[model samples]
Target chain A: MLNIVILGAGNVATHLFKAFETSESAKVIQVYNHRLESLSFFKNKTEVCNNINNLKDADLYLICLKDDVIEDYASQLKYKNTMIAHTSGSFPLLQNIEQSGVFYPLQSFSKFAELDYKNIPFCLESNTKSGIQLLKKLAKEVSKQVFEIDSKQRQTLHLAAVFVNNFSNHLYTIAEDICKKEDIPFDILKALILETANKIQTQSPKLAQTGPAVRQDFKTIDRHLSQISDEQIRRIYQLFTNSIIKKYE
Target chain B: MLNIVILGAGNVATHLFKAFETSESAKVIQVYNHRLESLSFFKNKTEVCNNINNLKDADLYLICLKDDVIEDYASQLKYKNTMIAHTSGSFPLLQNIEQSGVFYPLQSFSKFAELDYKNIPFCLESNTKSGIQLLKKLAKEVSKQVFEIDSKQRQTLHLAAVFVNNFSNHLYTIAEDICKKEDIPFDILKALILETANKIQTQSPKLAQTGPAVRQDFKTIDRHLSQISDEQIRRIYQLFTNSIIKKYE
Candidate 1:
């Protein structure tokens, strides 16, 4: 079995631990976090360490800590025999570590959310060929989709992810707000949302775009702006309208 | 049988004709368009008429024309005995038509695409109660999800749809652009996109929001913006970031 030590007790850590528990080739040797409260959940499942000094030897030390603390922890991390990897989209791999690599899973993690690894794309990179080869085995054991991506490419993936996931979700939030103000059930728009997403499956988003912005209907645009009472939403509407018009033009 | 005459040869017109062909009560007796070439597809399926004057008598005259031409067509339409309705999300019902209503299907329609009306939300509005009752039966025949929405609420739904469908699709377009630049397959983000939409089923979009912008991570925000070379997309990123920050605050 491939021994693993997971650092940090956030959403990613919790989900990783759960997935590792099911994998036949891997066992989490320990899970370490600075906070005792976060470490409590891992107590019965595996060895839980609150102090960084008590981290044990494992095949891989997967760091799932906050972005700010990742470099600090990695710089102070004292394991010489284990391969060190971080699960960050935007962070640079520590060159100071002897066998450093990245094992980034591209998906939003919620503490209580049920995660299915089949569809999630895992991006892996390592300084040494052996590190990448080992990481690949572990990745395939956990996920069906894996991509060999460097740090720069991984960073770009994260940025693009922010657009597709974060920004798109915010647009839904804005739609929900509009529905709330009009006392219309936001549920009505869910079908439209699914259809819009389904369109992207076979078509480029460029050709798939349709609205007043695409048709250049200024009258309808003005009418929509008039109904929007919130200043922020109105500005967002105008900005997107301008961009869309520019795109179609 | 409810004989129907459909005007226009666009995406919406084509889809409606197909759906109507499957309905037992409604049979498209005639498909009318000013352009003979646009009416070629309906030649064997139904009677195709190029001239408006040759329009056959039908129970309903469904005008699925362009928004700008909708009022013009309704005003000049000679079918006074029939219930004249236009499938427009934002256009007003033609007041001159004695029997007028709206048969707006709240979903994006594309040419050469399979459309299942089961999940599509049909927003219906009528000038008369009798008209609504008749339209409700027809709508139920076409789609399972039907809403009797007024002009104001219909307009609001259209606006919200702009955010969820149009704007969210644009965000996907932006992500595609980013991935294209990095030589990464846009397909990698599809699962994440689906997950984002699925989250709205059990949770509000506000509660589902995640990212550097949602977390107010200035370091990551700065990193993302610096990498985005395209001036317009960068501006969009900053604007959305500001909106998200204001939202969570």
Candidate 2:
């Protein structure tokens, strides 16, 4: 079994901890957080450390902190030649460290939801060839797809992910808001949501686009806008519609 | 089998034809299109007609024309009180014809892609009680969820669908464009896309949202924007990021 130590207790950290716990080939040797309360959940299976000095020696160290604090955390941990990894998409592999990499799971994680990692793509990157191979082997235990992506590619993927996932969910928020304001049942729009996602899986977004905006049907667009009283939603509808029309043409 | 005559040979018409063909309770008896060439696909199973005068008698006449031409086509149909219906989300029950209603499948249709209607939601509305019952029965054959939604509610749902599906998809298109320009593979973002959808299914979109934009991380946002060379994409990213930040705050 691979010896692993997870740092931080945020969503990504919690998810990684639980996922590794379930994996046959990996075992959490230790858990570390700046605060003792954050490491409380992993108290039974592994040793929890609040003090930086008490950080145990492990084969691999996975840093699951926010992007801004990754560098600081890496500098504080003085383990030489240890295979260190961060789970942030935007941050690059640490250059100052002798052996460092990224283990970015390209998915939205929540504490409540049970994540199925079978289809979840793991983007792995390391400075050393053996480190990459080891990371790839660990990734293979959970995920069907794994890529040895550099920091630049991961950044681009993260940006694209923001557009497809984050921005898309925001649009769903806008839709839910509109439905609530109009006193329409939100369930009425559920199937359409699933269909839209399925369509993208088969066809390109350019070919799959529909609505008054794509047709340039100003009358229908005006009618739709007139129904909504929210200024932000109206502006969003107009701006996005215009953007789509411009992009496709 | 319930004999059904479909009017118009557009995307909706073709989709309905394929759906009804698989439906055990219903069979398409005839198809009417302004141009006879469009009716070629349904020739074996349906009696194709270009002229309304040649329209055959059927249990139901489904008008599947565009919103602009629906009224015009509805006015020309010789058949009346034969469970006539229009496939539109915005159009009201036709008061001009007896037993007229709507059979709106609340999803986008594409000719190239095969649609699985088992989970697709269908919104049914009719002027008469019997018409509503028949439409509900017909819808139940193809979908698990069927609701009696009036034109007002459907219009609201349609508007919301535009936000959730159309606008959300435009965001995906933008992200894809950005990724393409940056030489990033679009599949890298698929895991995020699937997870985002799954997240919204359980939690509110507001709670499920995550990104540099939502967190108002100007440092990363500026960094991402600087990397993009396309003027249009940069503008879109900036505008959307600003909107998301504003919404969250």
Candidate 3:
């Protein structure tokens, strides 16, 4: 079994700790965080440490900290043979570390939310070939989907993720806001939202595309624009409509 | 059992026909369309006609035509006691028709796509109380979720649906485009897409929102913006970033 040491106690870190704990091939030996309060979740469950010097010698040191502190935290880690891998999408692979890699899971994680780990795509990158094999093995323990992605490809994936997850979710928030303003239950639109998301699983997004914008239904577009009073939202509606029209039309 | 005559053999009409076909309380006696070719699907199962003048007598005359032609199609229909309800998101209830109402299902429909009819929200509007009761009965037969929404409220719901379904799907398309250009397998992003969509089912969109924009991570945002070459997509990135930041920060 591969021994793992997790750094940080954020959403990704907590989820990873649980995932590793359940895997027969891998086990989380210790967890470290700067704030003693944040380490309470891992307390009594594993060897928790507040200082970087107290980190246990393990097969892999999975750094699940924020993007800003990853480099600093990794720089401070003094390891002999243990590979250091970060669970960040945008952050690059650490250069100074002797055995550095990336173990980015391309999924949003909330501490309380239940996840189907098998479906998550783990993007792995490493400075050495053996490091990648180790990362791949650990990733395969919890997930069926795994890819050996470089820093550039992973960064691109991160940007694309912003569009699919962040921007699309903001669109849902906009819909919720519109429903609230009109005294309409936001629940009514939930089915449609789920259906739209499900459609692309089987069909290509290009072929699955539908709406007044794609149809170039000026009448409906005019009506919708007239209804929106918010200047920013109206502009967003127009921008998205134009973007879709430019591509399809 | 209530007999219904469905006009227009499009996506909405076909889905509704199938939904009602399974219901013991309602039966579609006839389907009408301007083109004889479109009515081929409903030929053997039920009475079908190309000519609008040949519309059979039924308890409800459901006009499932395009928004622009709904009024003209309803005007040609000569009904005695049958209530007239048009299945549309944007089109309002027919003003001049004696027994007019809206039977709009606030869900996107494709003729070939399979749907979960029970989850679909059917929004009903009517001129007469009995017409509403009839619609409520028919709607409840196929779907558990039904609401008595007026034309104004239905219009608002339609607008919200566009934002959530249409706009969000467009964002997915954009992400797909981004992934394709970068030589990254688009399949990798699918898990993240499904997870983001699933989160809102239990959590509010506002609280479920995450990413650099919400986190105000300008360094990562700049890196993403620099990587994107498309002018419109970059602008969209900036616009959405600002919008999200404005809301959360």
Candidate 4:
């Protein structure tokens, strides 16, 4: 079994620790966090450590910290020859370490839901060939899809994800707000959410776009804008609708 | 069985006609379109006619025309007491017609793919009691979720849907374009898309929102925006990111 130690006890850390513990080929040797409360979740399966210096020797050290704290954590680690990796989409593979790479599971993790890593795609990158092979093997234990991506490519994918997922969810929130204000049931809008996402799976989103904005029906657009009392929502509507029309034309 | 005559032969017309044909209680008696080519799809199933005057007797007449053509088609139809309805999210229930309502299946339809309307929500609205009953029955035949929404409410929902479905899909298109330009596989972005949608279903999107813009991490935002060469995409990124920050504050 491959010995593993997880640092940082945030959402990503918790998820990775749990996934490793459940995998038959992997064993969690230790878990570390600055706060004792954060490490409580891994009490039974692995040795939990509050001090970074207490980090035990393991075959692999996975740094699942926040993007801002990653460099600091890397600088403080005393372990050497341990295959070190980070679970960040934006952070580059650490070149200073002998065996460094990335183990980013490209999916959102929440403490409540049990993530089926089999469906989640893991983007693996490393500075050395051996590191890549080791990380790839570990990734296959959890995910069906594995990709070897460079830092530049991973960063591009991260930016694109923000537009597709984060911004898209915000749009749903805007729609929910509008429905609430007008006393329309929000469930009426739920059916379209899945359908919209499914459409782009088969065809380019440009071909799938519909509504008055694409049709460039200014009269209808004006009428719809007038119905919203919130100035921010109206502004968003006008700006996004204008953007879509301009892009298509 | 309820006799239904479907007017227009666009995506909505074809989808609705096919869905209605599968219903045990409903049978399409006629299909009408001003263009002969549009009626070719219904040639085998119903009495396809290019002339509006050729409309036969039916319990309901559904005007599945485009939003702009809805008014024109309503004016041309001579039928009265035949319960006329239009399948549009933005268009209000026809006030000019003697028996009018809306049978808007609140999901995007494409001719190339088969959509299961069983889970798709249908928003039903009508001026008369008999019209409402007819629409409710028809909606029940295909969809499990049905809402009695008025024209004013539907107008708000449609606008909201534009933000959530149409505009959001446009954002996805923009992201895909950026990925293509950078030589990054769009598949890497799919996990983000699915997770983002899943996040909104559990929590308010405002709480789930994350990115360089929301966090005020100008360093990363600047880096991402600088890499994007398209003026239109950069403008959209700026507008949406600004809107998100403004909403949170």
Candidate 5:
């Protein structure tokens, strides 16, 4: 069985800990965090540590901290023979280390949100062949989809994720705001929102694109713009309309 | 069974035709389009007419034409003891007519795309009480969801729909473009996209929001912006980041 020490008690770390707790081939032997209060969730469940120097010896040290502190945190880990992996999409594969790899789960996570890690694509990268093999094995235990993505590709994926997940959700928020202004139920647009996301799963987003902007229906666009009172929202609307027109027309 | 004559053969028209075809309470008696080529799909299955004057008498006359021509087309149709309704999100309920109503389906329709009308909300509006009852009955035949939305509210829903569907799909296209440029398979982000959409079905978009912009991770945001070579995309990234920060911070 693989003994894994999960560092940081954030969304990714807590999720990873639970994912491995049920796995027969792997187990989270210890969880480390700088704040003792943050590690309260994993206290009774596993070995929790507040200090980085007090990390338990394990086969793999998984750093699931913030991107700003990942490299520094990884540097502080003192291990005799262990693979140190950081779960970050933007960060590159660590160099100048004996066993270093990246194990990034390509999905957004909230502390309270329930996630199905089975379908989540675990992007694995390693300097050594053994490190890659170990990550692949650990990833397969929790997920069905696994990919050998390099740092460059992973970074690109992260940007793309922001566009699809973050930007798209922001659009939904805008829609909700518009509905709230007119006393219209935002639930009406929920089905269309879900369908739009589902459509691109099979059809290309370029071909699946629809609306006044793609059709260049300036009349409707003008009408929509005139109704919006917010200057910021109007600017966003115009920018997106112009962008869509530039792409198609 | 209530007979219906559908005017204009477009995406909305085709989908509505297919939806009502299996409906037990409603049957499409004839489909009319100015262009004979466009009516080819409805040939042999139902009565097809090329001229508006040749439209057969029915209980309901449903106009499924372009937004620009819906008013003109509805004005041209001459019928007795029949209700008239147009399927448009942006267009207001037909006025100055004896029996006028709106049977707008609050979802984007593609001619070839398979659709499940069961959950699709049908926004209904009419001038008379009987007109509304008829529309509600016909709408309930194919869809489980039916709402008596006014012209003002329907217009607001249309604007909201543009944001959730069209604007969101454009974001997906941009993400695909970024992935293609980096030789990264866009399929890797599909699961994340679906999950983001599914997340909002229960949680509010504001609460569900994540990533650099929401977290105000300027360091990662700057890194992402520096990597992008496209000026328009960079501007969009910066604008969205600012918008998100404005909302969260």
Candidate 6:
């Protein structure tokens, strides 16, 4: 059995706390967050602490806080010998603490969305071999995918994730805005969005590329730009179109 | 059964022909293309002809040609009242032909990909009410989703589809490139990509948005931007990050 303490109450923290509670091999000994309201969700299930100084002794201290505060929290922690890990994608395995590791799950978490922990890939790294082994066992308890990624590779993965999730969703927002201005239902484009995301699963995204950009149809490209009056969006369209043309042509 | 003839054997034409063949109410009697190789897919399944002048009598003639050539194809067709319609999103309802309409299915179609016709939204419009009614019946035979969209709305939908499908896929390609360059397996981000796409189905794209940009985390954004060395991709990241911050914050 593994003893765990989650230090944060944000989306990732809450979701991880819920996931840990259900694991027969793991127990959430405590949950610590700065705000009392944030800690309310884990109050009944485990020992809740609003202060980091009051963090109880546990086998692992999983810091799910912001990147800026991670080093501060780890350095401030009074507990010794207990393994300290962060769930950050960009942050390195060790910063201010002597004993540190990473248990980064490469998936976006929302408070309302229910994620199956078994499906999410857990990217793990550590300052020591024993720390990594402990993280691997705990991660294997929840996720079938356990990757021993170094800090540099994890950082690259984080950057790539931003492009896939953030930039892709931004494109959807633009499409939604365009639909609203034209009094068109956005639901009509939902099938296209789903198909676009699903295509890359089996095929390479480079091969799956399509549209006026890939075809280099200048007339359609100009017409599409004319339709969008927003300068930012038009430039985005042009830039992406140029990139696609450069890639294929 | 409705007798349908498909002109032009491109990806769209091939997929639509296969879909219509599965329907008991619709029979695709002829497939026409300027190039003999393009019509080869429909050779054994239907009457394949390289000459448009050899077009046979049919209840509906679908000009599944490219947008630039749809007008020319419609004008050259020998049929007069056979309810001519083009399978184009941006193309208007009327062309040089007397009886023309739009049979735009707002979904990305690939020749090799298996598409569920029932889930795809079919947008229909015509010059006459009877023409639209005929299209609605034909569309209903295969698809559960049917929308009576006008020329302007279809144009807008096409533009939106560009953003959602074309632009979204471009971002995925970029991410794949980043992953390939970093020696990281692209499968790591597959779960995140699937989650981002699935979240927008139940929630608005606006609500589904997340990342350093959406959160307005400048430090993380700068860190991510630093990780990317490609000037074009860096600009893309910065531009998209700015857009997200502008939209949300």
| The candidate that achieves the highest lDDT relative to the unseen native structure | 3
lDDT of candidate 5 over B28-132, digit per residue (tens): 999998899988999989999897778888999999988888888777764455788999998988776789999999998877889999979999999999999
Candidate 6 runs further than 4 Å off? none
Tell me the tens digit of each residue's lDDT in model 2 across B10-82.
8898888888877898988889988988888888876899998888878899999888877777777635548
- How far in Å is the alpha carbon of B65 misplaced in model 2? 1.2
Task: Give one digit per residue, the lDDT tens place, for model 6 in A131-151.
Answer: 999999888888888899999
lDDT of 1 by residue, B95-127 (tens): 877889999999888898798887788899888
Q: Arrange candidates by lDDT, descending.
A: 3, 5, 1, 6, 2, 4
Estimate, for each residue in B87-174, the C-alpha lDDT of model 6 and write its tens digit. 9998777665567789998888888999998889999999888899989999998899899999888888888888888888888889
- Judging by lDDT, tell me the better candidate of 3 and 5: 3
Task: Name the regions of candidate 4 deviating beyond 4 angstroms.
Answer: none
lDDT of 4 at A233: 75
Please report how far candidate 2 places residue B124 from its true position, in Å. 1.9
Off by over 4 Å in 5: none
**By DockQ: ranked, best first:** 3, 6, 5, 1, 4, 2
In the predicted model 2, the residue pairs found to clash are none
List clashing residue pairs in candidate 1: none
- State candidate 2's TM-score: 0.94
Which is better, 1 or 4, measured by DockQ?
1
Model 3 lDDT tens row, A194-237:
89989899888888888999999999999999999999999999
Candidate with best DockQ: 3
Give model 2's DockQ, 2 decimals.
0.70
Clashes (backbone N, CA, C under 3 Å), per candidate, total: 0, 0, 0, 0, 0, 0
Q: Which ten residues in a row have the lowest lDDT in candidate 3 chain A?
A: A73-82
- Candidate 2 stretches with Cα past 4 Å from truth are B22-24
